[model samples]
Target chain A: MNQGWTERQRPPRLERRLEFADYETTRDFLDRAALVSERLGIYPDMSFGRTYVNITLHAQDDATEVGEPSRHFAREIDILLETEKTLDE
Target chain B: MNQGWTERQRPPRLERRLEFADYETTRDFLDRAALVSERLGIYPDMSFGRTYVNITLHAQDDATEVGEPSRHFAREIDILLETEKTLDE
Candidate 1:
């Protein structure tokens, strides 16, 4: 147990790594995500100049064998990012 | 860097620790959260029950001296839990 992780970091810089099914799904997910954040009163402060949303994915890794769920998530997040960009523009 | 974390854990057991402003807000957030998950094609499998939603709060911790944001989040999650219970009934 890294004591440094707990004591030094009171609440610590919390982050989320949500998985999804595919790109289209991720895009749909982001729409709902923004709504959820808004409802929670924790609006996304992209200008906060901090690592607010650090979303990563793991699609079918034909090279090293991945899980169905993992691949699905990676594809989903990727789609979410793409959709976010389009929505922004 | 704990090599065990990378090699042993392929995709790794991902978790999310979302923070909110207050209890009511968290409840609202949960409603949105469910919608978002469904949109993402990552519907909540509460039945699987393997540390899916591990929400914690740090509302006004007079004992250790916490921050407003942290306290706000804790209070929010507590409310969310309460609301979830009520919704179930």
Candidate 2:
């Protein structure tokens, strides 16, 4: 439950949908997010359209709670999106 | 109507699921597919996890038929996959 992220219960995961003005921005966000995953060793499931990407960070292992790692990954994604926006400004 | 593509009538979409051995290969295919969309002017919705991408090309202009353009785009995706495989060899 961090800002725009919604935490789901049954199958625990943090989900967020990010919107962009164009595909170029969307692609940039995606490419950078992938790098972040590699850096932090946390890969999320992502689905995208021309100007939007939905990211889901599922809880690690067989745990029943949305824990620290998912939160950290979500924070990283938030930072990534802000970094892209800052670059545009 | 392609080898791996299945046409869905209700939503009028041609859907295909592509499996990759690794994340790098998945990223390669996604990148190449984006380029193809730009080159061919046909965009399809893609959803992916760690090792698989599900692509759905919806019928254009509200038509009930999965038309030629959708088929052409699917063909391009198949070629893109093959092109990556060739590079890997």
Candidate 3:
């Protein structure tokens, strides 16, 4: 499992929750994450509130493991968040 | 509650699950939905798989109602799905 993600046993998914300072930043991150998902052709289950975003990536096909694509997507998400933070600063 | 959506009791939110024919279509709909959320300034908690997308919209503040924005967003989502179906035909 990745640092921020918790592995779910029943359905076999990797889940992560990220918190931001405020609503607009959280929403902006979601928008950017959506664009990244589109570009990468891999989408995560996502939920958000005023200050947090939750993402879950399910293991495909009976693999029982969070595949490379999911890992890559998660890493890319980290990068996106970092970039956004840099831009905000 | 809306036709395709269910009201969740504990957290007081509106939830819906939509099924598509294939993975590509599911992802495409997600991309479109993200754009709609951005445009509307309201985001849903979203999750998806090869053929299904699940969404939840939480009621803000202490209000137990789904609120105007969530309802409007849901209606717009229906319109988006209908428009996509027509284009696919």
Every model's DockQ: 0.04, 0.80, 0.35
lDDT of 1 by residue, B1-89 (tens): 11211111222222234444454454455455444444433332211011122322222324344344433334444455557668757
Best by DockQ: 2
| Model 1 CA lDDT for position B78 | 48
TM-scores of chain A across candidates: 0.35, 0.89, 0.88
Itemize residue pairs with steric clashes in candidate 2: none
Candidate rank order under DockQ: 2, 3, 1
User: Which residue pairs in candidate 3 have backbone atoms (N, alpha carbon, C) closer than 3 angstroms, thus clashing?
Assistant: A45-B47, A46-B46
- Count steric clashes of candidate 3: 2
Instruction: Give residue B84's lDDT in candidate 3 (0 to 100).
Output: 92
Give me candidate 1's TM-score against the actual structure: 0.34
Residue pairs with colliding backbones in model 1 are A20-A72, A20-A73, A22-A76, B22-B76, B23-B76, B57-B74
Per-model CA lDDT versus the true structure: 0.37, 0.84, 0.81
Residues A59-85 of candidate 3 have per-residue lDDT tens digits of 987988889999889989988877887
**Number of the top candidate by lDDT?**
2
Candidate 2, residues B43-76: lDDT per residue as tens digits? Answer: 6889987789999988877899878877888998
What candidate 1 gets wrong by more than 4 Å, as runs, is: A1-51, A55-64, B1-29, B32-51, B56-64
Candidate 1 chain A: minimum summed lDDT over ten consecutive residues — where?
A44-53
Per-model TM values vs. the true structure: 0.34, 0.92, 0.68
Residue A73 CA displacement from its true place in model 3, Å:
3.6
In candidate 3, how many Å is residue B78 off? Answer: 1.6
